[model samples]
Target: MSASRYQDLVAKVDAKAKEFHERYAAQLQCKKGCSSCCQPGLTVFSVERLAIREWLNERPDLIEKLKAQPGNPKACSFLDDEGACQIYPVRPIICRTQGLPLSFKVNERTERDVCPLNFEKDDVLALPTDGVLNLDLLNTLLVLVDQVEGGSEAGQRFALNVDEVTRT
Candidate 1:
């Protein structure tokens, strides 16, 4: 897939994420200035990195701010002074999917994941099945998009630092 194709896939993924957000709005209190999920340390794919880098090109201050922040913990670098995502519109699949009651198959077993703050401590089971995002499917789709764009089957990634992606 080309960059244009990648952008198309991102659009679809974002649409699905928006639906999930709407479906779970009753349980989710994740609004602006919420930094609970911003802690660092992550594996970001090449496609997502490129998208973010492109967005960052127009925001040099965000680049410098991210560079100055602590990077060892793997927190997102795109957060603004208020702890809200400055590039929320183009955040990666992971960032987009966070703070929701979601589930996936992990090594032949179904694992349900949810934000600690939401759902009142291990009440993830209470959320209707349809409300949770199937990250397993979404992630597989992302990997496929990466491969079609001439990236590795496993996907290209920069481990542990988001600022690394912004480097020229």
Candidate 2:
């Protein structure tokens, strides 16, 4: 998708993220040093590639670092020397919603997914479950916006590998 359109969508997602953090600050311990969810071999749609390309444009030094060290399939390419995300502000939707309470369908029943690091406290268990970001809806919106902005209109075709994106 076009950079401007992607930025708008990112802004909306970020706003929701901010709200989620505010609502569950104590329970969610996903801090900068925490890279447990940062794994490699992740696949993304074309729109995410476009967004990451935009993010890479500003961090030329990081690009050089990535060039010197090819992305490892077992580790996230965007992680810095300090284990912090190099493109945190412009990270993809999956990255943005990492530790939040996510719900999904399983065996014809609704199942809730929570990070093992989070919501362990009894007080947090009473927290509203509805506040978690709806990934299915978010992905649909991403594809819709991407198609509207001249991005690849492929349906559920996650063709872009994270390793390839880290290089060029």
Candidate 3:
């Protein structure tokens, strides 16, 4: 896909992410400068890799600094010296949903976890509403990526990993 198309997709995803954040902000007490999730050993998807590479290409010095960090396990290529995402604007959907009251099924049982900061709050409650998050927006972006590779999910995943892309 062209850079314009990628930009459009990123913009749409970012907008949807902001909307999601606003809708659930009261339930999530994730304050700024909380780098709990920035700890090493995180596995990022291909989309995140592509976005980070794009960010790095625009800032070679940042890339050099990231590579020069001592004892860096290279866990998350997106992390800079300050332990912040280099491409927060176009981060993946999972990153956007990191600290939310999300329900996921496992072994036919529903589970929930509040953000650490909100854990002690009693007034905060998980709304019974379903499908409030705009996950379809993320799916749509992935579909657009797949279409670029003749409708192959694997190809889209590969592109996100930056392994098959020349730009990375």
Candidate 4:
């Protein structure tokens, strides 16, 4: 039952992201081919990995396509050569929030962040609270949801190798 909460959270975030992307379409430089943020060696929490596995199980073709590709070493393994995500629908929260204005804390100080290519020279801090995604809050909620799903266990917390998703 708690596992479903994760989906709810994802739904909320996805809606917010979609709305923001639409309202600020001109400000956002994020396009389908843009993948500067899709760095290699990214790891997801166990709950997120479970979501990915479940999503792939429903679409074995994507799994086979992922397996056939000689993954890019410089970018995420799930990214195709053209820089599109193979698992966009079930991408991690971090991936979903990418290229958006995000507020997070660093050393107890609040900082504003956005993709360098996006909203250039515009002060993200000045944007209303609703305009920016509260990353800290989002992360906390995800951790709590993960805990409820039994993902807080020492070894089950995170998948060290994201590639493991393709094997099964």
Q: Regarding lDDT, does 2 or 4 come out ahead?
A: 4
lDDT (10s digit) by residue, model 4, range 1-168:
234988999999999999999988988999887999998877777778878877788887877777788856778888877898878888889899999999999999989999999998688889898899999999899888777763534125444233576444
The number of the candidate with the highest TM-score is 4
Alpha-carbon TM-score of each model against the true structure: 0.81, 0.80, 0.62, 0.87
Q: Is candidate 3 or candidate 4 better by lDDT?
A: 4
Give the alpha-carbon lDDT of every model. Answer: 0.71, 0.70, 0.52, 0.81
Model 1, which residues run further than 4 Å from truth? 1-3, 69-74, 150-154, 160-162
Count clashing residue pairs per candidate. 7, 0, 2, 0
Residue 34 Cα positional deviation in candidate 2, in Å, after optimal superposition: 0.7
Of candidate 4, the 10-residue stretch with the lowest lDDT total is: 152-161
Per-residue lDDT, model 3, residue 41, is 52
List model 3 lDDT by residue over 1-168, tens digit each.
246545566666566557757776665556454546544454444544555566667777755665566544543445556666655665555666666555555586655554576536643334554434434445666556545532222344432222232243
Error of 2 at 96 (Å): 0.4
- 18-124 in candidate 1: lDDT tens per residue? 78678767777777888788766666777777777777777888777777866434446667667887778667778777787789997999888877877764478
Worst 10 residues of 1 by lDDT: 153-162
Ranking 1 against 4 by TM-score, winner: 4
Ranking by lDDT: 4, 1, 2, 3
lDDT of 2: 0.70
**Residue 1 lDDT in model 2?**
35
